[model samples]
Target: MMDTMFLKAALAVYFVSVLGYVTSIYVRRVMVAKVSTWIFFLAFLCHTISFIFRYLETGHTPVISIYETLSFFAWAMAGVYLAFQPKTKTRVLGAFVSPVTFLLMIAASKGLEGYVSIPEVLKSNLVPLHVILSVTGEALFALASFAGAMYLIQEGLIKNKKVSGFSRMLPSLSDLDRINHFCLMWGFPLLTLGVLVGSLWARTAWGSHWQWDPKQVWTLVAWVFYALLLHQRLAIGWKGHKAAFLSLLAFAILLVSLVAINLFFVTAHSFI
Candidate 1:
């Protein structure tokens, strides 16, 4: 019952956040941006409280079920936006970013009535830590992907000698590229930690660390791909569209790992 109420509240907050971003898109005044920021803050506060209530109701980390995973995804997405906006000063990205958060929150709200029942084998502290850090890292990568997509689009506009309007709203190409690079640098380590912890947990729970399960294999693939990107960025000083293209490819692989493995693959890790 409390979870249901929290879900409803989360949905409301998601809607308001989306509305605030939409308002930001049309309002040119500084006051409007400030106002939008406040609206986003309010929504974030509500979201936090809703998650807290969910935690209380579940008596554990609120990540046991697919519904809860979606909720966490929403939380991580908004957390990234809040953490990055001040640094990037890219209000225009909010117009795109907020909606994704809202959509995930809404999806989370859809299946909130189920009890969070962890599998007997998954009842360990490591599982929660792995999920939280992994989702948080993935959310950061998701934001980077959004920035990369925008960079590509804006770069295209520049190539075609088109500018102004939304094109003008974006930051310099170099700024987008820099931000994506920073996100990748920070996100990769966290993802690595999550993978390590998950492997440790697998060892304790199943007597094996690397089972080559679809999720595990795909996650390692993602880590390897990012590792290559980092190597190129360091050894070759890769940046600009080259780095952005790799970021885009990494995100595609992540989506496949997140969605395809769970939906189509028959494995213990297919928890979607």
Candidate 2:
């Protein structure tokens, strides 16, 4: 009962945060931005508490269900945004990001009926660590993809003289491109560490470092896509739309691996 109430409250706050972000885009009032920022911060706090309570209620990490996994990603997304806030003027990007986070929260809200439990194999400590690091790392890369996609969209509009509405709300294309590259450069190492940790965990549990499981195969594919992007950007002087396109390509791979493949396919690594 308490869990239900807390979850409800958390979802409410997430919705409020979404509205706040939308309002920030239109109002142009400094006071409005301040209010919305506070609202989002408050929403994040409520979400943190809700996740904590859920954790206390269940001994397992909250990565067992697709809903919970999405919720965790939303949290990590907000965390990454908050971290980058002071360093860069990416607050406008939040107008795009907050809605995504809200949708994830709403998705999480959809399926909470049963007492969720971890599978027997997933109860291991390594599995939990692997999930946490890998998911969080992926979350950062997801944000980078969002930034990169917007960068390309905005870049096209500027190239074609169509800057208005949400396009105007975005930062300069240069800034977006720079941040996109920055995010990949920063996120890649974490992602590599996550893959490494997960590989070690897999070897321990399944007696093979590489299983070619659907999850493993797709994850490696995503990694290689980003790896190629990094190489193109650094070694071959790729920039602007090219890099942004690569980022979008990597994001597509991630979506297929994270969402589509996991949903439709059977695999030994399907913890969710």
Candidate 3:
């Protein structure tokens, strides 16, 4: 239970990092951005330590509860950005990224009161694998959406003939577009695999391969949307504005499904 302290501790550090990122954006200071990067690294380390404690106590991946899932999603997102950092000039992107992770962490903090009791159904190993891959894929889609949002902002500024200060700070359109494409290329397959594994787990837990659970249906909806996006990208060579718009639209649908359906619907897939 004491390890839960680490989760709180990580939340505090992440808040400070988010502030730093905001400041970096306001001042347009590269040094502040650099400092923010290290702070984010420290926050990520705290989150990792927190996860280690949770895993030690739970004897499973620490994504069973809504709190844990939010934590896991934020951590996976930060880790993905860090992994992509060296290859991209996305340091400024942290202004966008930190807020998303921080918001998830904040939502997660409300439930860190104590150890969460795992449901007997969640004891299945498939549950953890499904959670891990599925959340990671979702997290990647989040990043792609973030990048696409930035791309549109930059593109709009260019089209409107406005050479603003922050526009100079934003990454090139080519870079953001490439990141979106790469994320989709990778996120689609990972999500597909996640759905497949979840099917296997559903068979084990419910003795049926398909159910009309709102959560499951929404997840399938997200999968199909991503699949269509991928098909357009590969076959029709869609990129730039239309592709970015579709990516954002897909993420919006996924968000509605994950949040709205999970909260209001009487679905068997509701874990929160």
Clashing pairs in 1: none
Ranking by TM-score: 3, 1, 2
For model 3, the local distance difference test gives 0.86
What local distance difference test score does each model get?
Answer: 0.80, 0.78, 0.86
TM-score of each: 0.93, 0.91, 0.97
Evaluated at residue 34, the lDDT of candidate 3 is 84
Error of 2 at 38 (Å): 2.2
Off by over 4 Å in 1: 26-31
TM-score of 1: 0.93
Displacement of the residue 78 alpha carbon in candidate 1, Å? 0.6
Superposed by TM-score, candidate 3 places the C-alpha of residue 264 at a distance from the truth, in angstroms, of 1.1
Better of 1 and 3 by lDDT: 3
lDDT by residue for model 3 over 160-208, one digit each (tens)? 8886766888889999999999888888888788888899999989999
The prediction achieving the highest TM-score against the true structure is 3
Please report, as a residue range, the 10-residue window in candidate 2 with the lowest summed lDDT.
Answer: 28-37
> Candidates sorted by lDDT, descending order?
3, 1, 2
Runs in model 2 deviating more than 4 A are 1-4, 164-166
Q: Candidate 3, after superposition: displacement of residue 31 in Å?
A: 1.3
Stretch of 10 with least lDDT, candidate 1: 28-37
Error in Å for residue 112 of model 3: 1.9
